[model samples]
Target: MTTRPARRTRRTGPALQAAGIGAAALLALTACSSSGDSPSAPGASSGDSSAKLGGTVTVFAAASLTESFTALGKEFEREHPGTKVTFNFGGSDTLAASITGGAPADVFAAASPTTMDVVTGRNETATAPTTFVRNRLEIATLPGNPGKVASLKDLTAPDLKVVLCDETVPCGSAARKALDASHLKLTPVSYEQDVKSALTKVELKEADAAVVYQTDVKAAGDKVEGVEFPEAAGAVNDYPIALLKDAPNTAAAKAFIALVRSPAGQKVLTAAGFLEPAS
Candidate 1:
């Protein structure tokens, strides 16, 4: 046998800057970025039909999809025996940058088109991304609505402690939209990296309230209360999903995406509080 040397690698393009997500979670991509292989899924033709749905499918998705996607991942594994499904859920912008930075994921699901463009703009998608679900913002308050935050303006109170998503991510973008629509200016005590983090601030009683996705409030159960405002309608975010151009498990990726768009998938998502994709 011949002896071989381990390859030395360097960090590439703000790869470690997505602090909203665990640095250790993205450590798998700690190597030089490849220009990416051909933008084709070899065994699969086009769309989510796929060739054979075996192997592990690595999906980089927005944090909001945590619950629903987890259930779907389990369903997928059950539907296709011997197949494993793994996920890296985080802020959309962070996930997008990871994909473009050559993280070697099979699919990318973003909370908004703007975030999805970060990957698509770099030509990292095997095909056009499809909008799979939508979400609207809501005020997550203490379990009993102790803050009496009846409207978006209520969050502006100086005595109240509020948390929000950082402007770089999709949830933050939608929150900004809603605020702008209502002509409200709010300075959250801290800006979180993802919707789940923002909601957690309220659930943990660390903050009086936080602006996050309605789905998050529902997922939180009785730990927090949801307050819907009309302005949220203007800020609904459309989630998009696509196969990565250099996916290592294209067949599994396509099959997983197909399952997400299937009727059964929509049922699970809807039950988790996600809205249907706009036709």
Candidate 2:
């Protein structure tokens, strides 16, 4: 008598069926999205694989790195076909300034740590920089050494038309440190903005002598004669290189940096009179 017949449940029609189908479709889309990779994420294979790299990487380097980096750039291009490398070489300080001022550069190879600091301080570097090479100063005399320049003290001679890098440049700062370490005060005929400029003056015979980097003198070859001074040891310049934070070609940029720190890169720099970075 308490079992009044159990009521039969009503079955849902097309509306309920449609809602069930919609929910299933939504879940399928979610699963597909979750399984795929995001476009912005870095691919593990892209880093070391040359096939994944194919774009222009612009490098801004110090004048001192001109010869060495140029060689490295060519090698990089050879290793990764379909990649183009464009270089802008100048004073490290100037390059740092340009990069900080919205210049488009994929990589920066500075002549000194202080110059690299300029870019790092501005949050321009993607990662902590690594020192690749070091350099020391030398007096670059005309081909014939007509000034008879031999030491830092010889640069102080009134008869000699000595040129130095402007204090704003890395080479100039290193030159200043060198002169100070020697307790030598020199009044140069002019202060060129970069080591290359100062070296160029002596190469062109515009100045009787110039205080430039040993690398520069070596790169200049027969155009100038290098005179190593004892004080240069105290003013060694540590070159730091980094990939820019906003690099347009990050894959290629990283590869280029790897090449620069490679053994081949070191050989080129060492051949150009640059010292190897301490391990």
Candidate 3:
């Protein structure tokens, strides 16, 4: 009695290969669909991540930027929460010298491109400096016209006690340009190192008048009076700012620079009498 061999039910060569290929095709399809649904890196946002910026940013800025930049600094700190902004406000040239001389600073904002050139020439900036605003000269005089000063020529009155910025500074250089444009020779009773010091002379009544930036007079409020002169148009100083190459707070420094260039910053600067820089 020969019993027929049980029919083999096992999958042979081609059938096994076909099944394996089908399994692989399913996995490839699964992988392709999952790839399009991956999540983004955590904490990513439209703006720079706040977590990336938390440190003290030391800013060396021109005296003329004191009020506006200080306001912006407060806003910056408020926006950044844990970040702190410190400032050293003085003449652009003085600030540049300090930075070039190894002062620990994160950013530099100069009242003139020439002063900024001092830093850029030394390759101290992380990036090329950008002009943020333009400022024209204005004569800051004692309130109520105590000196009866009205024009740039009046600053030349022999009886008038006038103070100007040191010729090496931006304000002084602009003053010189304005004077040269008007073809008028006027000497100051003193040459202050920065626009603020020159404005301070008039504010404190130490001098009868000062040739300074319109923004300075505006920042001083009623402490001084502003007088516009036509020659100021020819000597408008372009303010430039940059992030330092060796900034202690590189992230915070870059954020501060962005704030200064924002519309909010332009509002503060313009409200302080600074002219909008050309696009």
Candidate 4:
């Protein structure tokens, strides 16, 4: 039997060259086929994988976020031309309930961690919620503060008609904490479903004052005036944002959350009277 040429032997012959070229071609074909059949990476850190993003990103956010989030949403759409941002703004507890009850949302931005827990507790979020901003309670009185409400305790005067967010809402919860911190008890004329409604009562002149976030008072402009109190420092709420586990448009939604946490997004929020997130 004839011995085969040594495997490592150099050969300048056309026959050897042809054989080497054929092997390389076979390997190239194998690599191409494997790469084509393999699965894609689960996600990119930028929330924009190699795939193009286009679709509506549905966000369930706190009622207090109406102004700032709306502004940020518009900016998001501008940055991602083909993408759309839709929001369901409401009381944090109500939003959390809707999410747990199977609402199709790509993101959730709660006014408080307790409300956020209502979703993260059930593993509805892709990751732990992140605190994007902090908010403090402020007394929202009619324009010029006709009620003369100067402190959280002032809302307690028997003659004043005050409105408070329902105890379940984040603003209400913070108000409660603030009241506890000050060791005072208050009874509002009515307990509204959300902070905006509570503030609306004051704006519409239905009530003398309402305990709401400073941002809401600022957003109201001439409709209302904000009164800051020392107790507010004790009850500042941390606003949290997260990507939903069942997000319909993951890439776009993730990108939206990223924008909300970005410096530009913080500018819009801070301009609306929201405080920066605690370090």
Candidate 5:
């Protein structure tokens, strides 16, 4: 009876045991949070995740971007691993029409800003465009001065077999502007759908001379001699690029756009004879 308050025994019942277990779980969760491995990590995983880059991205680019873009695409695949870039290269206008008609494309690169405006006007562009390159007109002629076509005015000579870009294409439109500025009239033997075709005619010696982008002549190398005309200054075309509004692979498209604006991509484009856009 004098044991007024026997020393209390430590709790060791099922309820106490359950309470301890609950405390342990709470501590473990706190540790996980402090260790930077909480549910937030999974939320972050869904953003900018490396797992989202394996899909294929289709790009519709101006025919002039064919060589440089192809090289960039190869490099992108090599660096990205599992990403594929499929390009549909043609006149910028044609590419815009294709995209507007619901063709699947993740990106668009045009040789001229005007053509890019066409696609952008339709709200087909996902982002603001960036000018990546500038190309000036050049007079391509057969090797060894066969036609002696040196100036824009000389192209007006009726005897010369001149090839020009169709008015609908960037190069053709630029050629017209340059000619109009110089007050020269050129009656081309054929109006090509794109610059490549116009340059091809001169490369094959099918035409005595052709007005094409300077990069085109450089790409052709010895196939055709490039003659820089003074009037070319009047017709410099700007190349622009942007992601498509309805891109099936938005991440990949943005990556491609970034690459094109990167130093590595610029080097490739420059090597192919394209000029870096003026600062």
Candidate 6:
């Protein structure tokens, strides 16, 4: 036997073709599995998943939320790198007006639900609002109780330089309710445009007393002394927050909201003397 008749030559063409086909099949399968357009693909970007979390967000918040929100803003930026938060803090009514007038804003935090309703009615809100905190009126006086303004009834005492928030603002409305509940008539020296302005009058000694949120007095610290009165129970103000309908950065807005609702955010708010929202 011709030992090995001539070494049979093995044809490599079919084997090579089969290997090529197998490689092509693997490529096609990979393309299908990784299709970015597929709804079930975890890497697909869509809905809340697609919302990229880095962008500038402009927030218009009530003056009462200034300190707490500012702190929270810093924390948010730290947690979400590449994000920036710009804030406009003032009276809720004024902030609402700015939003309705077409000012570019990503979020709004109002001192009162009524004011929030105003902004929502203007079609400026993108999402359902949530109450984040509650605040109550307090009598702010100069350090050392110089005025001796002891009670809501004392505020009506003649010659006391008492300042109140403008009636259009949340604090002013709450003041009215408190006064009505106490059956006391108050003739303030001035109707401040915002709560901080009212508190500032007390801090500067321009006014002996002012009706402001308890949080404001806490923020003022030694600048002013806070006196809690019984009538405040009747006039608690609720703080509400929501994303704006025309927000330039919706992802940032939602993230900011999440931060505010987070435990860390609550700590900041509570440290500033805001009460937790009712359960």
Model 2 spans with C-alpha error above 4 angstroms: 1-47
In order of appearance, the predictions have TM-scores of 0.82, 0.82, 0.82, 0.82, 0.81, 0.81
For each candidate, what is the lDDT?
0.78, 0.77, 0.78, 0.78, 0.76, 0.78
Lowest-lDDT window of 10 residues in candidate 4?
2-11
Worst lDDT run of 10 residues, candidate 1, spans 25-34
Cα lDDT of model 3 by residue, 2-83, tens digit: 2222211212244443332334323432343344432122311112753557889999999998877776776677667888
The residue pairs that clash in candidate 6, if any, are none
For model 5 the local lDDT of residue 20 reads 31
Clash count for candidate 4 is 0
> In model 2, which range of ten residues has the least summed lDDT?
1-10
In model 3, which range of ten residues has the least summed lDDT? Answer: 38-47
Give me the overall lDDT of model 2. Answer: 0.77
lDDT of 5 at 82: 83
lDDT string for model 4 (1-279, tens) is: 322221111122444433323343234323433444322213312234455778899999999988777767766665567888999999999999999999899999999999999999999999778898999887878766666767676788999998989989999988888888778989889998889999889878999888898877766666777777777788999999999999998878887887677555665677667899987
lDDT (10s digit) by residue, model 2, range 204-274: 88999898888777666567777777777888889998999999998899878876765545555676679
lDDT of 6 by residue, 121-158 (tens): 98889988889889988888878776676678878889
**2 or 5: which has the higher lDDT?**
2
- What's the lDDT of the predicted structure labeled candidate 3? 0.78
Please list all clashing residue pairs in model 5, or write none if there are none.
Answer: none
> Which candidate do you rate higher for lDDT, 2 or 3?
3
